[model samples]
Target: MDETAQEKKLSAHNASPTQASDHPADPVLSGGFRFDRMELAGAFGDLGTLLPIVIAMILINNLSPSSVFFAFGLLYLLSGFVYRLPIPVQPLKAVGAIAIAYPAVVTESVIGASGILFGAFLLVVSLTGLMDWMAKLFSQAVVRGIQLTLGLVFLKKGIELIIHKDLFMSGAQNRLAEYPVNLIIGITVFALVLLLLDNRRFPAALAALVVGIGSGLALGGFSTLTLAFGPTDVRLISPSMSDYWTALVMLIIPQIPLTIGNACVGTASTCTSLFAGNPLLAKAKAGMFALTMGIVNLPAGFFGAVPMCHGTGGLAAHYRFGARTGGAPIMIGAFFILIALVLGELGFSLLALIPRSVLGVLLVFAGLELCPLLRNLKTNEEYFVALLIAGIALAVPNMGWAFAIGIAVDFFIRKMNVRI
Candidate 1:
């Protein structure tokens, strides 16, 4: 071809079609689907991290799995449709998986949305650009105090899962001998989880979940079939609205801040730290995030479920694996919903089979993995922060002023001219 013709062809190839077109289906930039090994891993890895948490939450908290399912479903939908920045939503999952049960144990009913409320608190701060402003009023000591508290919250719960495996079981201590089947199932699931983690072929938690489901089916776990789509006298019994109101009221004081504060200081921070090396992306959408979860959770609650949240720990795991964006949450959330709905009894029964010892071992490994974070705290300020946070987490139940205590500690440290 002639030089002029060749130059014209090169120019055509170089120019974006949208730049040249009068109208385009979408801007050319929209066509590319970004993927990274760590982000993708983080997204997909959440399933494994979330499963055990789900099991523990369900059994210990006596919260409905439906709530978790709906919450997550909404979270993912909102992450994509609203936030538009596909940050992983696993922090809430990790937190909920561990903490939801405790609140349920206290309240005697499942609760939802408190975590979202907490997130809303932070979301408002972030959206209004107040985190930067608040950053000044508190010294590093105060922030570290909050960080330490968050870490210990996770660590303490991790220890509890391992140490008190039978605390949430159905029968009394004397009837333990009758639950050989449950022990076997639980132990097996725990072992399977470790095996999967070692191999990294499939997710450890998801593998455990599958094994639990299979075992449940084998053991005739679904024998007591009750729930379905149809509205009948048999299946349509409503949860006492008064009881629900009481539960919500009971949860309000604790959950709203717990969920929202944790999201800002814990989940957002974790994801930000984990994805530090990644390319710049837009800030996540807020209203859509809330709307997405609200859409699913409102329905799921009526059917007996706990509210779910995206967990940071779970998100970190996904990043370690290879999930790129919101796509991973969609997959995990959908899978969870399917299990809770179509295979409810089977899934629960399977989870019930895990052995306490094995479960303990799994949680212990997870907790130990966090030791390096402690090592990174080289300053006295960090030490103070970590201990203070852990202490409040330990004391919050016994002391009515956990938040006040944390703040007081921070104030005292700041007044003393501590440098962290």
Candidate 2:
């Protein structure tokens, strides 16, 4: 929506609180859209979270790279055109993680089928306004808890990559295996990003990628890459009853709460906070977020693509690195489409050139950007719930369980009329 139209909608509502104090003041919306160096640079913000899972799924599960990249490209374009904001679109993290870790169980048919059923479920919930009521159950503290939980999850994943703890998940073989090149490269890029994080003249993400790519080429990354041309293969899948059952039990059950808490609620709240000055932007609802995820995943599921959703961390990464408008995602969308065309099934191996450590740094920084969200949790009771959620999520290694425990405690406190 344009500024004038958004301004009108906000005024017609007949309400505007003193100021939306939900999250920290991130004034990106004030600039509208731009297609400059910074937007180009910021376009790569979420690749850290995006690339590894994509690579793993394609390499491990024999997924159609063309379909996956095409789905991502289309989804990115849809979000750009519809919301006209740099709203993040990411693979369903838990689903992708589980599939990568256990490719034997999460076969291509199972992954595709999971998308079909899960998308339908979210569509029902979103269209019926069920998520709206469910969202009200989430307090600011709970949202913060979700944010912290996902951030920590991203942090832990990045650390694991840097140290090469379980390297097979990403299909990334340590190219410079003799020594800890990933660790060294990770530290170098991490430092470079920190030094230039706020420098508009030289965006952090852009600088980091340049360094990482250079390091990768120096370490014999180019030898592994193969170039292909022409259209990428894409076809629909016919999932069996067993595929659906596996998807339901292993993928959907564990992923639902994270999708609800982080993807819908966490993302919408982060959008409102970052774009707080605009009531239209603030009006970006959890239902709308869910609807988009459902809409995209419907096709993504049919075509053997990994399920996708929004994330607070991706938004923070984009905005912090200087993506002011939908242009950032458009740039990325087009990039992916081009890659799918040129690289075809070889789309993933090209990225294997960059050190895993560099990818880890991107994830770490994205998580750090989410720290600003926790600043608004003022009271001790709020802190208790949020921190407890964070602790449980990391310890249990499950966002679904953490969200359940957090909301239960939130309701209990409210009913008791007591502070922690």
Candidate 3:
């Protein structure tokens, strides 16, 4: 080779390492901690996305801190090990918060990572190309039905927050203010979100969540700054094998749909709509991850833990933060592990700093994400099936049966050839 050509080759070889160093191949396991643009965006944007979810799990699920820790530990382990997705995983804190709000009202012990496990399974199935076949099993009507049902359910939940301002009290505070605060926060954030969503001028979701949360804090809305933060002395919970069985039954039956139907599907659709330029993967991924979550929950339930799942709230945050791959989840998982170890009264205290009203705002905005499904009602059979699913889901209070009803409806529709 000529000297000029050899020099060019040498320069190219030397430059490769620098180019490689500019970005890690994967965000989850990379050791150097060089923040990816998506990671930073997701980190900041997801905070609000995560807030209402975490709050809901705590209030609705009625889980203890120990249970929370165990769930996170399991989530961390599975996200890194079993699913093998490029995504980072964390305990669904929103699951915990939602559990707390509903308080075994819908599913028992909502603090665990069961939903997330399910989502992971669904994701795997999608990746493996099983989703299309699965999708064929149900009609577009059934799928849209499920989406509409979940949207309505979440909408009710948002309204319930508004309705129950008198109930969520702390110390001497009425917390009634939380209702209006939530309304204001939610409206403001949502409006901003819609605008930024169109332009991408800023990290819209994260900004909305931050503005809402920060406004709450600045206005004496909530404050965790005084709370403790360090290594927490967490006690691992050990429940009997029976408790596991009970938890398994509770999670596997009633709440499975929440994972498969709502969370997994919702997330996949959002991603497809936003990033990958296709919604087919969303359908497949949701089911794949749902199955994975089932496997994770089966064993973890025996350890006195609650189940976990992704929330639209968190996914919205993930999307807002610009998370392209699974790396956002991986980062979230690390956060869970750290909180499990270091959060105690301090952590709870920090959580306390978030006004219940502010959290309500988060939930309200989250519910709005489901609004796109309102278009489903424009169709006849779809509207009928969707309302039926929503009614069943809202009434039965068991997620399993609710999903079963929807799927069962699918069978009936197919048998009749009604074209629903």
Local lDDT at 93 for model 2: 83
Once superposed on the true structure, which residue ranges of model 3 sit more than 4 Å away at CA? 1-137, 159-187, 190-195, 198-201, 218-226, 245-252, 263-287, 294-305, 311-317, 320-322, 373-383, 394-396
Clashing pairs in 2: none
lDDT of 2 by residue, 1-420 (tens): 122333334322322121223223422344345687777777888888998888878878888878888788888887776676777789988899899889999999999998888889889999999998888878888998988877777788878777873323333455556777777778888889899876778988888888877776676655666666655667779899999999999999999999889888888777766664554474468888888888888878988998888888888777767675688888888888877767674555566566677788888988876765676666888889999999998888567998999999988887897776
Question: Which candidate number maximizes lDDT?
Answer: 2
Q: Is candidate 2 or candidate 3 better by lDDT?
A: 2
Native-referenced Cα lDDT, model 3: 0.47
Report the candidate with higher lDDT, 1 versus 3: 3
Model 2 — TM-score against the truth? Answer: 0.89
User: Best TM-score goes to which candidate?
Assistant: 2
Q: Where does the lowest 10-residue lDDT sum fall in candidate 1?
A: 228-237
C-alpha lDDT score of every prediction, in listed order: 0.45, 0.77, 0.47
Between candidates 1 and 3, which one is better according to TM-score?
A: 3
TM-score of each: 0.61, 0.89, 0.64
Q: Which stretches of candidate 2 lie over 4 Å from their true place?
A: 1-32, 165-175
